[model samples]
Target: MTAVHGDPILTSEEGPIRTTEFESIARAVDRETEGVQVELIGGRLGVKRVPDGDHGRILNWLLLLLMPLNPGLFLHVIGQGLAVGSYRKGRARPDGILAPPDAFAGAGEWASPDAVVMTVEVTSHDSDTNHRDRVEKPIAYARAGIPIYLLIDREAGKVVVHSQPDEDGYQDLHSYAFGRAVSLPEPVGVTFDTESLKDMGD
Candidate 1:
């Protein structure tokens, strides 16, 4: 497909963040018009991108592989996708985002961050890779009123959960480790079996 015009130019400390603003806009427009399955992230009208690297590819593959083990979960593997707004500006595709289907009102296409109940970002090789997810992403998610945020640390083998958004990011913070079950609120009755992820990045 041909590219659209007047799209925002998105850049990051790492370079062009994978997908371009026009491409993302095109996807959004296509979702709106064609009524196909599409998901978007809108904040500060900025671009969110992730590059194709060993870290990104590895984490993405791991998430995709583990997702099937839990058929009840409807997660979005937003690798090299977009999460706009906040201090750490640029393209940021989390390792994977655990967003359930029931979060939305109608049974149609997926909406942007506003429709998102939660987001997840697994740490990459470089500390810089998670700079946005660690700080700005949570801030942005809270600002957008998203209820939850998860940051999985591959290096530390720990998962951090943030909930209860307020004036400054999430008001509640909790941590979980492998073999432990994590309970998800809202859209109701959702739980994540994180033990499957224990084999990730090994």
Candidate 2:
């Protein structure tokens, strides 16, 4: 991650509180404070605790399952931010994001939502996290015109594949339990195995 200069002071009492600007947040994301994830929702900043070990296991499994089918595409795990909307009103970093390798070749800091093919989010322990991933993200992803949004709801013990994006969110949504397989749509024509996801409970 490249260092971003220009410190914008948010408060007089605190020294240089980071601004909600996408670039500022992106620059602030570093190894020293990797546990806190930053996002721009409706042009406002929203922070959340990163997912834990079990969340990572499921993400890894998904990466392994998808990478082989489309070698030209790149699968980005947590930390990479995606800029969405015309005004760049929102910047979201999904649990997993799949896009063409050259999509952001020369771009700096973030990738536009138009370049994204798919996004995945695994539900976390917090209700706010659940609401963001489950409800907010789908709407945002759809409005931004992403083709697919896959969500692994750990608390609900199910996997949901959302596609056919429209003005009002995904037109198609398919839900399956942990052991069932969910078929991805065109551009990524494959069935994902959810058997291993059962281990997330352990």
Candidate 3:
């Protein structure tokens, strides 16, 4: 496949703290906060929105499809932060991470993506979704060498499957409209039935 193009570069926001410091702060915030989730992306601090009911419904919809098809893989939620981006400088908590059961055993807050096959992101009804989910996340996950990145875009009402990761970015990008059957690529192959999501994500 031709290289996917036009993905904006993931740039830092000139943080006063380094990635190491952000880890400490991120943990403290996660401990203190109730609903929100914190992340360090592109050398900047970010707040992942508290998922709405529909946001959760989207994930649950995926859970049904993923489990039956891929018995060997498991979906890890519950704030599974990953060491992502170049040199693991970025920390991102994907909505769902696909890996073997107990893959994160004995790991800290931000686990390695070595055994992870795919990272799932469901867009929330928030202003930051564009930058966090659309632009920076694909780059971040790709840089982490994750084989596949599945995006359930609420705003666009589509499902985007990204695969063939390299240092620069994902080499293949396939997008399907809601209700259309979307086939995710290898390493974590699972075709998606997004029909239930047709009216959700509003």
Candidate 4:
């Protein structure tokens, strides 16, 4: 479990846990652990493994492609926990959050999604990648009104760009294999090549 994307491990029927209790649990895990990230999505707890070297490489590759294209925007990782899902109740920490610089200023752990234009996720090697990255996330990001949800699916060996968010999920979708290029829609106008991912290992 070395990829950046969180591995979804749904908790057993622990009955109904309050938001305060969920936050307390997440804080304890984050404080005591070293290479784990906790998320409270859909009222269930999920643990994310520490990112491996390939994950770091992909992140750096993204930086090279985005910096020159959008100087006014920024991409945040690790510490940028987002308030996702309906009513901003669910907490999610994406691989990278794209927004204008200073969007998270004064926003503590879980920030609002108002300024978030895009959210990026890099799939891990775990079997839960399909459920977590492909299914749950699209709904959560859309519910949060994030304009774009970028899925770098390592297993699928493709880049799935989700945009045109509606109440349920993204209305528009375009997928490109590792060797192809990707074009993101507006509010975030940028296009890039994903050919280098061919060597990144699925």
Candidate 5:
């Protein structure tokens, strides 16, 4: 498959992929899904889905419920691409994406599809949570310069925040439990309610 942006064409090479190539592929992908996120750059191609088991569904619903609380918060459901191409390749559908007003203000393409304020991954049945959260994603978002990373582990009932990406990986790391509240990075300072998540007694 190809991701097309303007006249160029892009595809994932399963290795060190270029930004321009990824952008082209992003624009070329079929805009067919009602809620699917189409992204290019990082590594993989096609539709990359969030872990959508029972817990995944509940966390997704809770993310949708976050809409009313933070008006500045914009929720991109299960399979929506956030950034296009700049650092990595492939589209990762976070359970929900919380973007501030300024980030969502512009009409046309704002930043890259991967240019998101906060990216959340609600863990479901993944046997290797650390792999996705600590290893692969760090490379992807760090390269893209994503501001913050939020990972919710339903099995462990934990919410981990990896904020401020640096040359290596995330700088600030914080973990919270069920009844705790996590405050997002600046410009918004929105306190994400962990209590309202899927199995957390919302």
Candidate 6:
């Protein structure tokens, strides 16, 4: 079996185990293993496959678009984690994140959501991955006071922009199909062209 990040590696003969604390996840991140991503969800460690080729392409496109538009802000891709909610109850590793350059200055392995201007997630092959990005993560990001959350649903071939977050979930949500243009609100003031985004298999 191939080794996936965040999942337990059987270093000893004791077999597989899951990390249950935020510190453990942080320590794993400090190790800096390649092709591995770790997220702390509801205080439990979760491992996921690194972003595939299509995911990387979309992220790069967004990075390029954002750099010219928001020259002062920083753009972070996969492997950068954000500490969400109070006391780091949840940690989210987004496909891409836009924030101030000093956001995590002198900070630890993860950054607080307060520092994030916007976050993006591209759906993976797993249904749970889809649900996390579409359902759970939005609520988490909202609760953490993140202003914008962009979910690229490869399975649905649509991009959903969520904003105006309150105590509940985002109050505003606009979705556009693969070929349409989606408007991103202020702070990240720009309209995104989803026409070039590749579908799941293509």
Q: Which candidate achieves the best lDDT against the true structure? A: 3
Model 4 C-alpha RMSD to native: 3.2
* lDDT pick, better of 2 and 3: 3
Q: Mark the regions of model 1 whose C-alpha exceeds 4 Å error after superposition.
A: 1-73, 78-92, 98-111
Looking at candidate 1, what is the lDDT of residue 68?
Answer: 72
Name the 10 consecutive residues with the lowest summed lDDT in model 5.
Answer: 2-11
Ranking by lDDT: 3, 4, 2, 6, 5, 1
Q: What is the Å distance of residue 86 in model 6 from its true position? A: 5.1
For residues 1-202, what per-residue lDDT tens digits would candidate 6 score against the true structure? 2345334332322113233344574566557656666565544445566777987887787788778877888778746777774344677788888888777777766667777889888887653575467776888788788899988888888889999987677999998988888898987888866667754324
TM-score, structure 5 vs. true: 0.63
TM-score of model 4 vs. true structure: 0.91
Candidate 5 stretches greater than 4 Å from native: 1-53, 83-86, 100-115, 198-202
Model 2 clash number: 0
**Residue 198 deviation, candidate 5, in Å?**
7.5
- Candidate 3 residue-wise lDDT at 158: 89
Off-target runs (Cα >4 Å) in candidate 3 are: 1-15
Q: What is the RMSD of candidate 2?
A: 6.3
Residue runs of model 6 more than 4 Å from their true location after superposition: 1-20, 29-34, 199-201
**lDDT (10s digit) by residue, model 4, range 1-202:** 2323455555533327555676887787777767877776666667777778898788778867887899888877756888888776778889998898899889988889999889999987665667677987888889889999999988778899999988789999999989888998988899888889999845
Error of 2 at 48 (Å): 1.7
Candidate 3 backbone collisions, by pair: none
lDDT (tens digit, per residue) of candidate 1 on 87-157: 32323344555555454335222235555556777665443435445776677677656687877766777
Q: How well does model 2 score by local distance difference test? A: 0.72
